[model samples]
Target: MATDPNGTTQSDDAIDPVEEENVSGRASFTASLLTQGRHRFYTLSMPSDVLANTCVVEPRNEDPEEGFQRALDEKRARDIANYIDAGMGTIPTSIVLSAQPAANLQYKRTNRTLSFELNQRAFLILDGQHRVFGFRLAKTSLRVPVVIYNGLNRMEEARLFMDINTKQRPVPNELILDIKRLADTESDAEALMRDVFDLFDKNADSPLLGLMSASERRKGRISRVTFNGAMKAISDSFSGASAEQIYDVLSAYLICCKSGLREYSMEDLIVNPTMFKALMLIFPTIAERVNDRHPSSFTVAHFDEIVSPMFQRSKRAELSNPGKSPSLLVDSFRKALRSGFTIGGGNAV
Candidate 1:
């Protein structure tokens, strides 16, 4: 082994003949020096034929065939492959790799060829494994771009895998609210209420629990835009409140309201955007009433206490109520709020 001037020991394994470029009109790849993080690595461009024959996926276990990476989602892979075959979209994404030197690999910068034994265990795919596999299915001679990390252990490879998959994947529309909540790009009232929106969507005990859809498989009951608008109407209540405080107080009242209306389906009450908006119009008043009743020791129970009377009053506003027109719907919710808590209310339609 040879030590660099910086005390970093470079791999001094025997130079395999694979490091030599092919002059026999056969396929070959060359590497360029790339920045090193925990270990040295190189970037290269290889033909799809070479990638299919040489690249390997290091799986964590044998129970699920593709457990280490996402399950081989063949349908998705086939779709991408078909797209490639049709020459519709160019696959410009690079395949990220982590190779264990002990697993028969050598990074020879002097020769510019990344030498490795061709097998399924030679490397762990940190990213773009699906794309690589899809290219294999495409059976085309397209070039595959790659970034290979040398001598990465399993943990380091896993971390890189997670970072790439989570950060690089397109943000689902349902989850745009979450990313925006943490992002500093927009600090307006609507953006800030996304913090509360996340709570209602994710928290288990929330009335809005499991109500927001974040994936193609399941659709959320209410639209995010409508929900954000409702929250914005009551944004002043959240002015000095932390995410936890906003979640706790709102969750308490909403959960109680959900439970109180046992006769009506929770679905019926929550699926309607207008009803949700009307309640938001009245939420500030509910909070004030509870705070006034228990000035120092305000608790979830107090919020629940205030929401109890509104339950019976709001029943007429249910989507199932035949005689309930849109105007009457808003009026019923206002009456419901006034029955239990004193609120300066107005039309929410």
Candidate 2:
């Protein structure tokens, strides 16, 4: 430790850069000059142990709840330390630092030595707090990279941090595309459709459970993409209904349809996307007529009544032919529903 004229002790190993470009007369640190976008800053490579001793993290932001930098996460730090110990090549990105003008730090260009009269707390970490914490946890003497912005006020430091995070580090294109397919937030209808698809995937009572493409393919015959498309194709059919309500109605209908069959596999119906799409197109009309008589009392019998005539007219035996298009079954079912089916008591018309 070296004592300055003001009686403040500083690190004896404090370094000064061999080259520095003066900027606005506040560049008092010797460092290699680097430019990013329009901002020029100083870069330094220092030992991890030295940085642990010389720097301190000061958490600052306009909104504490939604701040850019957070408190040192010890769990994350320990994980990083363990990662380093495993001999896995972990690249240490640049840590950002800032110092206020009140610190009275000076750099002598000739000898390339920094003369400072302040303690470690005089410095602020604008970014990479977790990395420094990790180094402390590791207790390793590894070299770390850092970027310094001298004589910056709190506002300037925060702005620079925001710029470095939001403006420079863009999200990868592949990630955006993946997110688009997974959780598309284009419209309310798309969001609701995803929720309904998830309902089919997760609900144990659902006939389509474990058969939708969202679940593991052990018995899941439907592809997630195809199921989502089917749901979107008929999204407007369930206007004003909540996601759970839509799921319940669909689940009830499928259960009824399956119960009426003497012997049929849910997997068989799910495997064909065309069959699912045809169901989507036909469900709305059937649901309206059944709900009128049953009035929220949906049952397997009601499903039988609605589906029996349609099945009989469609000559579903023809469905076994691989050469037949699904539209044939769809058209026949639509015609049967229009011609009206008997509900055991009388004609549904």
Candidate 3:
């Protein structure tokens, strides 16, 4: 017999069928036995409440090889907990764990049932500690998929933990954004920005046609990651506007920029990620100026009439200063635009 954390005792030789409650008062459920090479494991669904109470994480001490897991990130756990409590989150991946010999876990192959005593520190969390902690914090209980490896020693557990954490490459943000766009799973703001990117890449009249690189960086092309980042700085400016409408205003602005700043190469000033973002940051003021003068007209010609003189007066060396930071460059451009313009015998630049 083995004693659990709560002083409950259970026979070590006991094995129960599916859906039966064992002597320790914990319910035993059906599980699938799986093997990879010589190693065997069991996959089962455990309720969040039970899982949270049963599993423990042993973070490494001052000794380098003492433990396998890292310290729990409290903020991440809180965020995940909040997401789960809001009824909008789902954890589809299995929480991987190892049952040490002390756990006394029993699996009945005839009925495909697995049961274990709730002994203190019975299971070691190999992965998904943050998620498990989130489950512990959430008010609602969830049926979580769990993979349990039985009778693994400390060294074996450590090796498995290292392999999982180090060998797997995380998905890139660019690919995630692209997937969200294609699957229509993104938020409204994200969807709108993605559509704007599509127009800039494919539209015939766009000044930036064939200049948006979706995956990786390319010569003379702006990456999707950079483009999305720049758009975020001005996304609020297009409130209540459709993707096409937003594209129209921006495309017109860029056309004017391309024409007015013809002295500099496209990659050097206009389409450079830093310069492009700086340009986007100042667009709201320019749009307001256009709206004030033309009253709802935002054409390329109208923008040119306003910005052409500013570009003419500005020095390329100063505008493309490599020493200045991106924010400083934006401020310099704003100052230049203000200093260059004079409306009705007063300083409007």
Of models 1 and 3, which has the larger TM-score?
3
Q: Candidate 1's residue-wise lDDT over 1-349, tens digit each?
A: 6677888875532222343333442333457667755566777776675666556675556535333675677888788788888875688778888765533665556666666655556566778767877887995667667788877666677777887777876855656654564665557665556667677778777777777643222433765666776777787877787877887877776666566555465445554666667667777777787777788344667867766666666664464552423446656656776664334554211
Q: Considering TM-score, which of the candidate structures 1 and 2 is the better prediction for this target? A: 1
Listed in order, each prediction's TM-score against the native is 0.44, 0.43, 0.74
Taking every candidate in turn, the Cα RMSD to the unseen true structure, in Å, is 14.4, 15.9, 7.5
Per-residue lDDT of 248-320 in model 2, one digit per residue for the tens? 7788787755543324333265456666677676777777778888887666677667876665554445444
**Most TM-score-accurate candidate:** 3
Q: For residues 89-137, could you state the per-residue lDDT of candidate 3 as single tens digits?
A: 8888999999866567888778787888766566889999999998888
Give the Å shift of residue 102 in candidate 2: 59
Model 2 lDDT at residue 308: 63
In angstroms, the error of model 3 at 213 is 4.5
lDDT of 3 at 283: 81
Q: What TM value does model 1 have?
A: 0.44
If ranked by lDDT, best first, what sequence of candidates would result? 3, 1, 2
Sum up the clashes in candidate 2: 1
